[model samples]
Target: MKQVHTRFPVMETERLQLRKIEVQDAENMLTYLQDPDVMEYYGLPPFVSAEQVLDEIAWYNKIFTQQTGIRWGITLKDEDKIIGSLGFLNWVPMHHRVDIGYELNQEYWGKGIASEALQAVLAYGFETMELERVQALIEPANLASIHLVEKHGFLREGLLRNYEYGNGKFDDLLMYAILKKDFLASSK
Candidate 1:
């Protein structure tokens, strides 16, 4: 595959805008990242400071410049605050594969924002990024996230034992994936 653009490409949906994570957006992003409920299934503990979010944003930019992967801040069209963040991590252009991850504010749960953002990213992964396979490794307990990926036609490939060691314990993860062909067919 060719090299991805160094700049984070902004993408927009009807109700949300997916753009590069700005330092100014840190506080808004912390509204969810620091929420215990929102970070329940996450491997890392809830963020305790805005500085942590700033570090995360810096990492996002670093990877984008390296052409590895990109993460976008999900913001409401009419609102200035970011409600969530989503993107592909661990991109392997040679293998045409990438891992997807995302988190949203609890307030936005069940409102379809996650779905909309995910669908747009999936389309871009397949069409724009020319990815053949996109995978999401979700904790088994995260039913909502599992459902979101399933709605996009991601198959439950397998359960990896002790997949991630975090929060003082080894966590099991359920791997879900969608192929370019399958996603395209389902979108029709």
Candidate 2:
């Protein structure tokens, strides 16, 4: 099994309050996953039942115990309902890089919450995790995600065709990345 990096407590952004996933989030997260349009491009299909979300949350809860940063339930300060989720997985600490992914409720799309969440995580990765780089493997057609990474100063690395067998098709993944220097450079 892949070794998990050391984990930490909750983190937040200007518009988001990212907390560790609890068993309770399973129900609310279903609203985000149940929407077919919201999940079409995502690896999974429209959720059939709440059980599946529970199963996922269960696994994530365990993963969160590890040092490896896995996932977080994305919520708002006022609402505090999990409207989306995001995190790093497949952590390869030796390489100083990790994979980042996130999804939000369709109702919240184009609101720029994704970008805010991503920036906070990127900062955490670079400062707390002491990472030299972080990468996002986005579906080529996922222009929204592409823009999110770009807006945060991630550079286009390249495309990996047939990168993942997801959503019932051959998906090409566009690699976007930010080096530690690059991240600091833009901040200055």
Candidate 3:
């Protein structure tokens, strides 16, 4: 792919806005990240301080500048409030692949925000980033995430054993990938 731009115009969907994580989001970001249930599938222990959340937001800002991958703050368009976060985590330029991950506040569960954010990112990855594939490494126990990816037409490749350490034990990973061709075909 050609040299990529680190930031793009804010993308607006029907109900959400996908934009770069900013310092202003630290407070609301904590509101979601600090939630035990929200962090459960994301390998985060309960956050004890808002400062810790700010540190994470700072880290995300650095990641954005480095072009490692973009972390978007998902916000309600009308309310203009951050409800969750979703973005590309691991990006491999040489391999033309990237790892996807996201978390939503428990209060916002079952509302399809995760899916909307995910779909937007996947489209951006394949179309804007010109990637060959984008995959999510989700813990199998996170059934909702697995189904979310499935609903987006990401195919289950296989289970990657002991792919991540989480909660307390080594967890098996469920791999779901959507190749550019696959994404385009599914859209058609």
Tens-digit per-residue lDDT, 16-81, candidate 1: 999988999999988899999999987889999999999989998987877788999899989868
TM-score of each: 0.97, 0.91, 0.93
- 155 in model 1: Cα distance from truth in Å? 0.2
* Winner by TM-score between candidate 2 and candidate 1: 1
Screening candidate 1 with a backbone cut-off below 3 angstroms (N, C-alpha, C), the clashing residue pairs are none
Q: Which parts of model 1 are misplaced by more than 4 Å?
A: none
CA lDDT, candidate 1, residue 136: 97
* Top-lDDT candidate index: 1
Instruction: Give the local distance difference test score of model 1.
Output: 0.92
Which number leads on TM-score?
A: 1
Model 2 Cα lDDT, one tens digit per residue, 1-188 = 24434544588777789888777778899988899878877888889898999988877766566645578788987887999988887666777788888999989998888888888888888886778889888887788888888988999999899988976788988889889999999878
lDDT against the true structure, per candidate, is: 0.92, 0.82, 0.82
Query: 1-188 in candidate 3: lDDT tens per residue?
Result: 34576554478888899887767777787887878888888886877777888888887777666777778888889876788887776778888888888888888899988888888888888888888989988888888998899999999999999988877888898889989998888877
